[model samples]
Target: MSLDPAAVRAAFAAAVNMDAAELEEWLETPESLSVGQKKDGALESVGHAAGRRLVTLLRSDPGALDEDAYRLMRKAVGFIRRHRAQEPANMVTSRWRYALMNWGHDPLK
Candidate 1:
């Protein structure tokens, strides 16, 4: 993703409304553990892993950010946007919401 750093930052901020504290807390939940794809019988889902990385990214100093960091942010923004568009009827407890939440997006918010 060769996105402009500023645009990626803005889009990411818009997509992931959950702050680091909120996302950190959410990531520890069983619901977070229960969703997303686990390729090749992996223990953790892709979104869950991304959430962990997102935590680190959220906590890092803005001045220290790099292209790789922006790339992850841009990718996350895309995932959140695409997933959000597929809003399920009962989002309160839907797996779709849970998956997005794992990626640091709380659709209900």
Candidate 2:
């Protein structure tokens, strides 16, 4: 199945408790991110990190993402986990993971 940017954004916003408008402003399309971009410091925001991950995921084949894409996805999962941990009562984690799985990515990995 094809990746849906709206769905990805919605899932990310839910997972991070970020405003969808804020996420839209922070999210850059996959084509805009340079290959040389560095991931050094803590991510700017969960929304930004999740948006980056979604871009990477969209660019790759879900069944076999390249190493860099996989790494990005893993980082996204980490960011999601960190945010989710802050709100133990929130049920968005499972829904977010389910969304990812539907896009052919098993974030559990």
Candidate 3:
């Protein structure tokens, strides 16, 4: 099924209660953007890596991510990144923040 990028971005924003622009900025930095590589006229290596990391994190808990939740998160990250010109930092950061929160961690703390 095809996923809508805007919808994915909006869902991410709502889930994390963050400013989407802030996340977009963070995603374009040298660090994050640098991880991506050209592939089939698209830059998805970085996003795929990010999604896999999230999946791994959830999987490690053994019961954290059911099939549907895992699939949706993967789809959201992949679809949004694929459809955007500039990377979606807001969506990326929302995922990162969510992961950190899941582990009782904090970037600011």
Candidate 4:
């Protein structure tokens, strides 16, 4: 399935309980933007990596995320991690899993 970059960004903003405009700045950072390459359809491949980073941010910082958003982010992260684990051979999933690990969260755990 193809992923829409806009929708992923929107959902990520909502998940963090941040205004889309404010979130745009964070998303534009070199690290975040570098998650995927545009030439390889990185939007679809790297969307989950971006989401993982956001979730990790919220997780490591206290009071940075509202209770509801925290719960939703956890659920989303868990779901994505689980899905990626189930499809170990898929390149997109493998990349996402590696990204999660690089960010300090192990998808297999």
Candidate 5:
């Protein structure tokens, strides 16, 4: 089962600070492409895929979001929250920063 939608919404609001256009542009960058685990030699990492979903989620109406969308949101929220605590000394160009950005969060913001 997915997380509580209300809790997900609250955590999501706090975690996902980037807009759709901004996230879309970020996902196109080499930095965005460079980090995260890519299973079975797949081109895109899980975080990259989640960022794409966040972009879509940002654009979608809150009332119409499906459970799967909520699940994705919950996952992104958890990932963002956990990784945010592991911030590197070099926030600007660190792989940690890149990984978080891939999940639609710019800690620098």
Candidate 6:
């Protein structure tokens, strides 16, 4: 139920197709991503991979996890910015488009 940094890091590395060491170097400051920190291109890649991992965890069966911890996990996942309004619509993948479209729908609806 707790956020396993090691498992998350491993999943991120595989999801992003980056070397674990390389990602470690890049994420060295995740706990302190400064206001002036600018990754330009690389951060986007990492964020997307991390976001996917987070989504997987968020979508997992609720009863299988600690509700309080899951709530915090969802909050943390919400912080990732994989989509930007300024991006052209065509720039988004069809999969992302579908996911984004469904994202706004109420699951209970």
What's the distance in Å from true for residue 49, model 1?
0.3
Candidate 3 off by > 4 Å: 1-18, 41-74, 77-109
Q: Compare candidates 4 and 6 on TM-score and give the better one.
A: 4
Which pairs in model 4 have colliding backbones?
none
Question: Predictions ranked by TM-score, top down?
Answer: 1, 5, 2, 4, 3, 6
TM-scores, all models, native as reference: 0.94, 0.35, 0.28, 0.31, 0.94, 0.26
Q: Give the clash total for candidate 6.
A: 0
What is the C-alpha lDDT profile of model 2 across 25-104, one tens digit per residue?
Answer: 33443322321223555434334455645544555455565555544445555556554454434434544443333222
Compose the digit string of candidate 5's lDDT tens values, residues 23-64: 999999998999999999899998998888888989999988
Give the top-scoring candidate (lDDT). Answer: 1
Q: Which lDDT values do the candidates have, in the order given?
A: 0.91, 0.43, 0.44, 0.46, 0.89, 0.37
At residue 25, give the lDDT of candidate 4. Answer: 47
What does candidate 3's lDDT look like per residue over 1-109, in tens digits?
3544356445544443223344444444554444444477776454545544443443344345455554555455444443443433674455454333232222433
Off by over 4 Å in 1: none
Top model by TM-score, which number?
A: 1
The full ranking of all candidates by lDDT, starting with the best, is: 1, 5, 4, 3, 2, 6
- Indicate the residue-level lDDT of 40 in model 4: 63
lDDT preference between candidates 4 and 6, better one: 4
Global lDDT for candidate 5?
0.89
Candidate 6 regions exceeding 4 Å error are 1-45, 55-59, 67-84, 92-109
Candidate 1 vs candidate 3, TM-score winner? 1
Distance (Å) between predicted and true CA of 85, model 1?
1.0
Q: Encode model 6's per-residue lDDT on 1-109: one tens digit a residue.
A: 4566445444432333323343344334442132122266454343334434444544555455554434434433343224323334563433333232222211112
**Candidate 1 clash pair list:** none
Q: Least accurate stretch of 10 residues (summed lDDT) in model 3?
A: 98-107
